[model samples]
Target: MRACGLVLCVLLLGGCSTTTDPSYYWQSVSGHLRMVGAARPVDDWVADGRTSEALRAKLRQAQQLRRFAVTELGLPDNNSYTRYADLQRRAAVWNVVAAPDDELKLKQWCFLALGCVGYRGYFDEAQARAFAEQVRHAEPDVEVGVYPVPAYSTLGWTNWMGGDPLLNTFLGYPEGELARLLFHELAHQVVYVRDDTVFNESFATAVERLGGARWQATASEAARAEYARFDERRQQFRALARATRERLQTAYALATRAERLAAKQRAMADFRQRYDALKAQWNGFPGYDPWASQANNALFAAQAAYDELVPGFEALFEREGRDFTRFYDAVRALARLPKDERRAALGSR
Candidate 1:
């Protein structure tokens, strides 16, 4: 889930001012500030001879997509995604997510006003790993994961400072993937519930999938073909992951603890075997092997956050006649409902 920049001030300052927890506050504040400090205007990069031609082209395409997002898709025309930032790292932030070893349910981290979320993000990777280790130590039966986040949205909270910027971490994505990333992040700014991970992430994922298809339709033929190949593989991978999650869920529900553990091992082994078979279809793609090898409850829960409820949102979009404004309005209306009512309204579990 995307972290709102406004929440940072509250999380950081409120901790120091109101609560006794100052260390966590200081680290969060420092990390976020450092990231925001690194942004530079896209034009500045373009004018510099230091910029590579490929990067220049991608930036130009990003500008086009930004306009399409606002004008064509009715997304907010804000300072977000208008500028660029070079994180000079492989990832923009590292997120710590945890779940019980015996269940797929995620552990919640509650903030003062933001309610609770399933994960916490740190700009520093080491800090994220440390936090994950702490969680593991605290709960012996907890499964923890430290994963990298390429980009995140502040929900337009930093528009005054030029909103969320295009980052090097994600700018190098394939054309369709890059457009989807921007659209997905920007969708977070459109409608965000305080503590509903399923609602927020699934909505953004729907937008990315929906908007990406439209973008692809108008893209150059070469770009379309390239994305087709990438997306097909991605869908297959997601299907495999989802199937494994269901198997794990079933395994965890076993009557006996010993049986559950045995089933869990079998499911994991099958997951790896299936992934290896799928990898062959991709002509030796190793991009997802690391994830398959280290699959755990925390990782599965994280994936479900983005994947679950997506079908429901997509159905809602179709019901809205594929109109962006109508779809967003409908989603916002649902967002106002009580959590249970909201999910019920969407006809999703």
Candidate 2:
């Protein structure tokens, strides 16, 4: 939807021709319900229906999450999810999404709670799919799974309470790290520097580690185990991200110099060849094929972005002595600083 007549519609969600009413969110739920009723349906996927059992299970899960959100997260009881869909639809979804037509309604929900009202969510699958397709067409190396969308991307304006159900798995993590995953994404929602992919992602990476424990405390033992599994997987990811970052440094030096273009190409080709071999060397570990085939301009542009400043996350975590709350305040404080100022702060005592 258009925010204050601005073209803020995330084009991938099958956005309509005109901008949406951003201020509409300022209204109450009754107001949002009326607003959505007048809008046009977004995509063909909107008509696709879930099975009865699926709906029931989703509702149950959502109820669980609603309780979690309130009991653990301390959100308001009367969340927007209540007005949108019944327990069934909300439970099935891990995040709440706005349809092209329901922009104002979603925004209202966002504006009202500043976080999710319930545990479960609603989303426009078509839009998420469209964004996925666009991201894919733009950069094939990045693989996204719609398990839960990145909260930072969707909930920023709403104050990072709600989250999308989409996730990235370019390099899959090990089992039992669900808490880490949640923490990582939540961290992104907490603070993000616009268009600065590396800084934003790295900050989230650090938070995921620091915040995992607190988030897990709300869930059951099984959920906590999942976080451990996820952690193991992350250990491997750290290696890959670091390697990618170093490799990108080399690649970038070559990319900038015209005279070395051909040499760089040859070097990259060799690097890819070695990378493939390197990937194969750890055959039982993980597969790199599916993503490699989708290489494009974005892939080249963000080739080694995965671990460019991993040490920053590591350093922050270490500096806080693994104190989660302290880490949170520290980062949020730093986020207030300008780019260079933040860097200087990081470097100074």
Against the hidden reference, what TM-scores do the models get?
Answer: 0.94, 0.50
Candidate 1 CA-lDDT value? 0.82
Per-residue lDDT of model 1, residues 59-167, tens digit only: 9989988888888788999888778888789887777888988789988776665556788777788888887888889899999987778887777777887888899
Cα lDDT tens digits, model 2, 1-349, are: 0000001122222222232543322222332233234322222113336435544444344445444444443333442222122212211222222211101111112222222211112244454456446544664433332223222233234222222332221112322243344345445545655434455655655554444445666666776676565455445544554454345445445533553445445544654665566556556444344334443223333323333455676687678876555666777787777777776655531
Query: What residue pairs are clashing in model 1?
Result: none
User: Under the 3 Å rule for N, CA and C atoms, how many clashes does model 1 have?
Assistant: 0
**lDDT at residue 316 of model 1 (Cα atoms):** 94
Deviation in Å, model 1, residue 28 alpha carbon:
1.8
Worst 10 residues of 2 by lDDT: 1-10
How many residue pairs clash in all the candidates, one count each?
Answer: 0, 28
